[model samples]
Target: MATALQAVEVIRDLRHSFNIGRLQMCRADEWLNALLAERIDSGEKRSLRSSGGRKKLQKH
Candidate 1:
């Protein structure tokens, strides 16, 4: 899991092309969750679920 400081840094880097101040106004969990959800939806990433749960995970 990312520390709050690390998450902030990530959000900062991602905001380089946008409004940093506005980006900073978002809650860290909200940003992180959205990023993860996007990656998962793209089918380019493996779910973090254990192998035993992977079959179930694929239902998503």
Candidate 2:
């Protein structure tokens, strides 16, 4: 049926869009990590709070 075909097309489009969005998120996370790595100091301790939880990167 025509209606069923249309529904399939819409679902395909949505899946493609979701994949693109996930790729963008991965790139953004990589960029942010690179930026953070540059500002961290070897002598001091700091916590990086992200979506999962807080992680201790260094010790004072």
Candidate 3:
């Protein structure tokens, strides 16, 4: 769940990376994956911090 700002930033980065990849003749998928992973990890860290480092358990 990326915020609006984060989403916009991702889009901007994607375009930049795409152009660089094209100029360098490299694959964009790898770059895209790394960027997405970084964003996800950061989002997880933010959520954890917001919850005071305590996660609630769910019952099955």
Candidate 4:
């Protein structure tokens, strides 16, 4: 499993790649979810957006 910091780095890199058109949106989403799964649960996804949560380890 990747550490939360590593997951954040992976997410940032994937977003950068997508912005550069090197990665399609679908592929970027897949990669992000895959990396995030190492730390985040599916149920926490909504809270991340809804609550404006920045830290991955924060409560949902």
Candidates in order, TM-scores: namely 0.34, 0.35, 0.32, 0.32
What does candidate 1 score on TM?
0.34
Per-residue lDDT tens digits of candidate 3, residues 1-60? 444345446766876876654644344445645644664676764553354333411210
Window of ten residues with lowest summed lDDT in model 4: 51-60
Name the runs in model 1 displaced over 4 angstroms.
1-26, 47-60
For residues 1-60, could you state the per-residue lDDT of candidate 4 as single tens digits? Answer: 444445567767867776745456567667657755643565655545444445654443
Clashes of 4: 0
Clashes of 3: 0
Tell how far residue 32 is off in model 2, in angstroms: 0.2
Query: Model 2, which residues run further than 4 Å from truth?
Result: 1-20, 41-60
- Can you tell me which runs of candidate 3 are displaced by over 4 Å? 20-60
Global CA lDDT of candidate 1, please? 0.56
Q: Against the correct fold, how does model 3 do in TM-score?
A: 0.32
User: At residue 50, what lDDT does model 2 achieve?
Assistant: 27
Question: Between which residue pairs do clashes occur in model 2?
Answer: none
Among the numbered candidates, top TM-score falls to: 2
Tell me each candidate's RMSD, in Å, in order. Answer: 9.3, 15.8, 10.1, 7.9
Poorest lDDT segment (10 consecutive residues) of candidate 1: 48-57
Predicted candidate 2 versus true structure: per-residue lDDT over 9-57, tens digit per residue = 5645765777657676557556645545643553222423321112232
Local distance difference test scores for all models: 0.56, 0.44, 0.49, 0.57
Q: Cα deviation in Å at residue 51, candidate 1?
A: 17
Model 4: residues with Cα > 4 Å off, grouped in runs: 20-60
